[model samples]
Structures are given as C-alpha cells and as structure tokens.
Target: MSFIKKRTSHNYDIYESRGHIIGRITLLTGLIFTFLPPLFLWLVYGIMPPSKELINGIISISSVMLPVSIVEILAFSPMLGTNAMYMSYLTGNIANIKLPSAAIALEVAEVKPSTEEGDIIATIAIGGSVIASEIVILIGMLLIVPLSTKLNNPVIQPVFQQILPALFGSIGAYYILKEWKLAIAPLSVAILLNLVGDLPTAVTIPLCILSSILTARLLYKKKLIKVTD
Candidate 1:
C-alpha cells in the first residue's frame, strides 16, 4: 500500500503542473498581443519612431519604471500567489485593482495568502474583478467623448484630479486604522521625506518600504504588536 501510494502520488502536484502550462500559454498570448500591434503599425506605415528618440525614451522610462516593477513582483508575488499573478498581469492594474481585490477577498475568507485555499480565493476574486473592470471599461469607451468633456471641464477638473488621492487615502485609512502601530513609522518617514522637496522619486519608494518593514520588525520584537502564528 505504501509503495503504491508513493507511486500514485498526490493530486496537488498534477494541478500545479497543469497550472504552469496554463500560465505559460497565457503569458505567450499576452506577449503576442503586446508586440503584434506595434509590429503591425510599423509594417503597414513603413514608418517607425526615430531609433535614437525611441532608445532615449526607453532608457528614461525603464530607468525609473523597471526597478519599481521588479520590486513589485518580489513584494507582491507572495501575497498574490501564482494563479493570481497570471490573472493579474494578463488583466493589468495589479496594484490599483487586482492586488487590493485579492487582499480583501483573502481577508474576508480568513485565509493567509500563498496557501492553496488562498490561491483559489484570489483567483476567483481576480477573475471576477477582471470581468467587472472590462464591463466598466466598455461602458467608458461608449461614453468617452461625453465623459472626457465632463472630466476636463474646469468646474469638475479639481474633483477628477483629487479622485485618485481620495481613493487611496480612504483605502490607506482603512488599513492604517486596522493596524496603526505598524503604519505610523513608515507614514511619518514618508511625510518627512516628502517635505524635503528634492529627494529622487525612485529613492523615496524603496526607502519607504524598507523603513516600514524595519519598523514593523522592531515593534514585533518589542512585543508592542503581537505576532500572529
């Protein structure tokens, strides 16, 4: 029975194998969509942006964006797990929409992320969110002209401009309220550094992540915050 069981193996491994295959297929499809459009434009027009200008643009964009993207992958993957990552990257908006939606779903389900159950919950949440986002985008596309006019109208511009800040502020306030002790040190440092007015944007982000992590560690060691199992 033992030998047969060993040979038979666990079903979870099979699921993981199939998941990897699906993820790779999705990644390939995403890459095709990404490159095919630009290639088509270049082929049809027989025109491309100036090589030097494109190179400079790439460099300027990559220098700042690449590091953040790498950091985000490292920082977020554990919370998102593999299935969620596939869905998130494919659909876009990992930070603003997918990640938050996954986090909230996991919290509601009372499951720690990266676990099997968490992966299932995250995948479901992200899938639903992707559908909902697409529907909203379709509606927006249909109303683009009117929406753009209203948004750009002088009376409404301030409100539109403030929407992002207000949204993040409310979300941040919710988490901070839940665990204010863990948030204080990082929030304080961010506020102080921002007041300096000359610090590089790239430097500020990693500094904030590090400071918050270290602060949390110190608090945990001091038992100011109870460590969960």
Candidate 2:
C-alpha cells in the first residue's frame, strides 16, 4: 500500500517523524541484514526452484522484507496511521501515542486475555507453530544435506567470518549517529554473553539482568548520573 498519509495534523502525528527519511534508510539496511539469514539458507540449500514453486512465494516473502525496510512500503508496513486505526478499532479507543504495527498485531492477534474457558489454548498454539516449523526445517535438512553436501566446496561457508564485523559496523554506524552511549552498553553485555551461553537461559537471564542492574547501580552510586539519586 502507498504510505502517502493525509495532510491532517492528527494524521501527521500518526504518520510523520523528524527522522522518517533516515529511519527508512537505516531500516532498509537493517532489513537487508535481516534478509541475509533466511536468504543464506535458501541459496546455500537451493530450497525452492522457480519452476516448481512458482513466483508467488518470492513475492510473498519479499513483501515482509519491504515492510521491514521501508516501513509502509508494503501493505502491512508499520505505518503509525494504520497502527492508530487498528488500535482504535481493536482496543475500542484511540490512544494518544502511536504504537508500531508489531505491538498492536501481537496484542490483537496473539495475546488473548485469559478467560474462564482456559488459558492453555494460546500456549498450545505457540507450541504447535514451533513443532510445525521444526518439521519443515527437518525436511529441508534431509533434502539439502545430500544435494549440497560438498565438504570443501568454495561456497560451503564463508572463508573469513565477515558477517559479524559488517553487521556490527552497520548497526554501530546507525546507533552512533544518535546514542553512542546506549549502544555501548548492549555491545559490552553481548560480548560478555558470548562466553556465558553454556548456562541455561533461566540462569543466564537473571544473571545478565542482575549484572546490568548492579552495574548501573554502581555507576549511579558514584554520582555519575543524577536520575538514580
């Protein structure tokens, strides 16, 4: 859908932002990085040949990325106007602040309030999707392992593990433009996390959370930041 919003002030707040242009640029770049994950699997495995699967599948998948990149470039793009409208309809009232489509879609579609009938159905649906996805991936592994199993093939794996630096540079460039300090904290924690993943998430989550909070507390205690004081 065209993202050209109407000219009303209310609509402007719904659809416009100061960094709309830059947001589109970085998001498109981010989306390109996001596309690399699945696209790598498709190319490495030759998952779908055009002759059998037809062109529609290509179009369908591309739409998801288009929205990720250009926000409202696709029908389900995270347009604030659309978000406001959906929120107004779904929750029975328009909110003062705009929410992204991702949040509203989750609210309206996935997260149902618990009722007397049961809360188990939602959990079952999530588990069911997980199982179904695993089955599909297992089938792909079976088909592709034999077809493209050359151990020493040139394209088998990247010679230099370049994706890491490239991703970090791209994301770092974007964040450094705005919030370099906020960016550093996550990068610091992620580096620390790489060595600690052997721990269960149940353990790791609390550890990381507690560590970050304690670190923040210590920083605040030194009178470095006034909010905590």
Candidate 3:
C-alpha cells in the first residue's frame, strides 16, 4: 500500500512538472500569435492608432477584464487543475464551455477535483470540447452568411441569448441537487444579489464562492456533512 501510494504521488508530481513546462511554451506561443495581426498591420500598412488612444483603449478594456480574469483564476484553478487551466485559457470560453465540459466529465468519471486522475480527465475533456467547439464554429461561420437573416429574427435571437443561461442552469441544478445543504448559502446570496441590483460577475462570483466555502466549513464542523475518501 505504501509503495503504491508513493508511486502515485511521484507520478503526479512528474505530471505537474511536465504540464507546467508545456503549458508555458504553449501560452507563450499563443501570445505571440495573438499580437501577429496587429504587428502585421503596423508593419505592412503603417496603420496604427495614436499612442494615447492605444493606451486608453488598453486601459479601458483591462479595467473591466483584469478583475474578472483574476477572479476566474482563483475560482476555477482548483476545479480545473493546472494543465486544464492552461488549455482552457488558451482556447478561451472557460466559463461557458470549457468549465461545464470539465465539470460534467469529472462527474461522469466519478473523480474528485484537484486529484491527479481528475486533472487528467479534465484536460482530456477540455481538449475534446475545444475541438468540438472549433468544428461547430467552423460550420457556423460557413453557414452564417446564408442564415444571417433567420438567425437575426427576433424569435431566434431570444433563443441564442438564452443558450448560455440554460447551459449553466442545467449544470448548477445537478450540483445543487447533489449537495443541497452546501448550495443553500451560495444560492441564496446569488438570488439576493440579483434581486438587489446588477452586480458585476467579478464581484458576485467571488462573494458566492466565499459564502459557499464558509458554509461548507461550518457544516463540516457541525458534523452536518460527511467527507469521504
């Protein structure tokens, strides 16, 4: 038993070490590619925004996105594990697509998050989802010109708007059903906040996460929830 445990730990450590090295290389490559289009325009066309305007543009976008990015990293890292996090960020759509796919994969595989097995499963699931989404996007792009009018119809527009909410709601429902006690605090907070006013996701998500963590801790201390290995 000791030998098996040690071997598993060793393997996991190796996986994490390699994952980090690969992740960094891939992310750096992606970053370079991301700047390529702007670089091309500047070099070939000599077309560039004024320095002041560029700075302001960057600041405006960053002000909104930086907080959300930080919050997402904190909230998602544990569930996604290191490798999956790298891939999800690179692919984009972490919240709407990668996250749900990874979560559902974990649930289906009966693996707990933050474990070696869970990390491996999540990475695979995310990769698959990325491929699937790309294929769908390709198809959509091809069809969009032809279908633009139909897609923009008011009835269809409403359905498109609801798609993300429906996806999240379904996943949330499953988890809440499984752990209703743990859901109480966070769910209530989310609902109350929605009723009170429109809060940015960066604010509401972190608060809900904090509330859930505290509630879980309290429940565990009171012997209201069981921890199983």
Taken over the whole model, the C-alpha lDDT of each candidate is 0.83, 0.45, 0.91
What ranking emerges by lDDT with the best candidate at the front? Answer: 3, 1, 2
Clashing pairs in 1: none
Writing each residue's lDDT as its tens digit, candidate 1 over 31-80 gives 89899888998999887899999999999888888777776787788888
**Candidate 3 Cα misplacement greater than 4 A, ranges:** none
Name the lDDT value of residue 205 in candidate 1.
74
Best by TM-score: 1
Top model number, lDDT: 3
Ranked candidates, highest TM-score first: 1, 3, 2
Tens-digit lDDT string for candidate 2 (66-148):
44433222222222232233322232212111222223333445443232111223233333444555687789888776766
Cα lDDT of model 3 by residue, 11-125, tens digit: 9999999999999999999999999999999999999999999999998788778887887898899999999999999999998889989989998999998998999999999
Error of 3 at 10 (Å): 2.7
Better of 1 and 2 by TM-score: 1
Better of 1 and 2 by lDDT: 1
In terms of lDDT, model 3 sits at 0.91
